[model samples]
Target: MLTENESIIRFFKELGLEVTSIDLGIASEQERSSTIQISRDSYPGVEPHLVTIADIARWFPELTSSGDIRLKQPQPDVSNCESLDIYRQYWEQLLSVTDIIMGFLKEYRTRFSRGEYPTTSWAHYFMNWTHETWDSRRLEPAPIDSWICYVDPSIRPHIRELNEFGLITRESCSGHPDDHPAREPFWPYVMFEERAYPGISAHLFTLADMACWIPTYGRHGFDVSLEIPRDVELTRGNIESYWNQLISSTRQLMPLLEDYISTSGVDFYTNMSNPSLFRMPANFQCKDMSTTGDFSR
Candidate 1:
């Protein structure tokens, strides 16, 4: 039988993620462990949280592509009143989704793990009886180019799962240790694209629900955002604890997202009107989640 440490490394190897570091947190040595943690250089910089109006213009050029309106990235001394108005409209759409998600998380907790605990290898649970986490990790879907460059192994599958609900992820970080010489803002977070799909209400609510149901939430709940990218920040400070929650939570999220699609409807953006779909807001509109291809000129 491969040791838990090796199991983790093998898991990442298959996922094509470069493991920068791995520390099998043993419950005996650490207050609570047995949850293996690893850090890969999958994501290079701090995930962008509060991007400027100019950033939105670049991200969703389709919205700014009228012959009358053009956007340029703001230089240090530049000010943009035109883009500012458009930015407000974008933010309003994003905030509408955030509000819906917040309400859902605040109202429910029964389906989530009430407290953080040491769980066995996910590879063992999800895979055949052979290697524990190794097998389980193999079953996870491969990451697309954009996601592979940013989303860490633990969080990548969930990103893919989000797509099943008609959501698009913009950026993600599995998180670094507090003492890793970085600011806290470089937290464990998953940022979603503020797609114009029914205005992102479904995406926001799903992420908020992810925070509540993700294992080990009893102590370390996520900090969901109200601004652009509309992310949820994991509340753990230590790297090991952070990865544990991220990876372990994913095991449940996969099936849950499927069940959500099966019960509510696979076309997530189209199903916003389904009150059972995270009890979406009354005025929520379900629209196509695709952006018109990058509008050049």
Candidate 2:
């Protein structure tokens, strides 16, 4: 089934209405899911699923007329409280830092290509850049527990929605480790490694991270990490080429997440213990968390 956004855009085009834009960025995936849930509660037995653009428009008339949908959430007042935005902030910060580091790597790569041995300053410079970036509050490695809290009960459904698209969680943390002492310790986030690249291989596009945190005393949000592998040659051209490939593979995450929020009716409650089969929607395979490896709490 086409996602809510895709359906809306297609429907509007069919109606001869030029859709300038669909505002999925401002509203979070969880908020859309909440809105759909509200509609389900209000009109019992209408349909268990909300998959088409008309489904959303029928429930939210404003979107039909204005091409914008905003669902009021029972959330405390906070600036940029949307989970997607929070996630975007974190992802973009890391991307920006990645760009900066990649710039240096490019220079190093160029020198290496010319058969010049890298000076110790290259390593020192990389460390310095990391320190400066963290000091600026622009980028930092998020704790996994905080991410688990922010996504549970709301945001994670969208993550699971990715399963339908051939992406599954390789490993995850429910964030409450102490609850099950006999089981593996609770982790803070989820990791999708080589499995993220279905047909593709090589370290360049094999890793992604999803995490969340409380940016303020009361406000909570999410962030993502994409690991771009440094080529053996360590050349800037190679780094950029690989980076582009990584982006192309994972760029759909935000948009698809927004669409899932708007229309998905799935709430996956799979038991991770069963590695051989997943409870996810059809066409998606069950995850194997055993090979996902240990993560920082």
Candidate 3:
């Protein structure tokens, strides 16, 4: 299925409209997604359709056009009180407005970070770049590669246990510590061997596939995102009780990871060739909690 943004861009082509992402790198999430430039593709002389939320909302106001106002959510006013539900809006109708509004907000934030807002009080604000770790979706240039690896003292036993289970351990961290070097992720993670393709390392990938079936991995709130080529650098996530989460997942899921030995029924990860598979989606690690280790997730 086409994503909302992709589908809109596709329709834009039919209508002789076009969208493209451009860089004016005062970093914002928009650079990773959303259309920055939209223009008329067929008519070279026509001006770009630099539409905004107010404009688009006007274009599609039939639902709001003298219809049941109760269908929409009301803007709050003060009795020092409550809100009246206007119209219970529809998803598809709102999505078009959402894309344009999101792009607008992205630019607004980027400009604010750049201190371009016209307000004296804003003069005090400056670009606040902090140390951030982007997700590692790569299998190469791993920081370490060895069967004998040093992990957090708490995670060491778990590591040894997994290694003995035949999932070759590559790298792991037990999340933030008091003396945290600041380079490591704030969440705990394990990097195990995965088959780049069917060969000696195939079992590792098979085990990884089995891990996907362990219901406890998610039910217990273990926010572990699994990226293929399983690089330790970036395919990481944050968690509460991170070590306990790691230990519990190992203890509870081991039997399950081990039981599914036969590859006959397995769905081996099929998109190992895509480079993006090696990297977690943007802001995935930045999230405080997330979904499972399935490469598809």
- TM-scores, one per candidate: 0.28, 0.19, 0.26
In model 1, which runs have C-alpha deviations exceeding 4 angstroms? 1-143, 151-167, 177-185, 194-237, 259-297
Q: In candidate 2, what are the lDDT values of residues 129-164, reduced to their tens digit?
A: 222112122122233444544444422543454343
- lDDT value, residue 110 of candidate 1: 29
| lDDT (tens digit, per residue) of candidate 3 on 183-278 | 644445565543211111212222233232111121122122232222233322433333344444445433432323333122223332221211
**Model 1 lDDT tens row, 174-235:** 55444334555454455544321322322243333334322111111221231111133444
Give the C-alpha miss distance for residue 157 in model 3, angstroms.
1.7
| lDDT values for all models | 0.32, 0.29, 0.31
**Using TM-score as the measure, which candidate wins?**
1
lDDT of model 3 at residue 148? 40
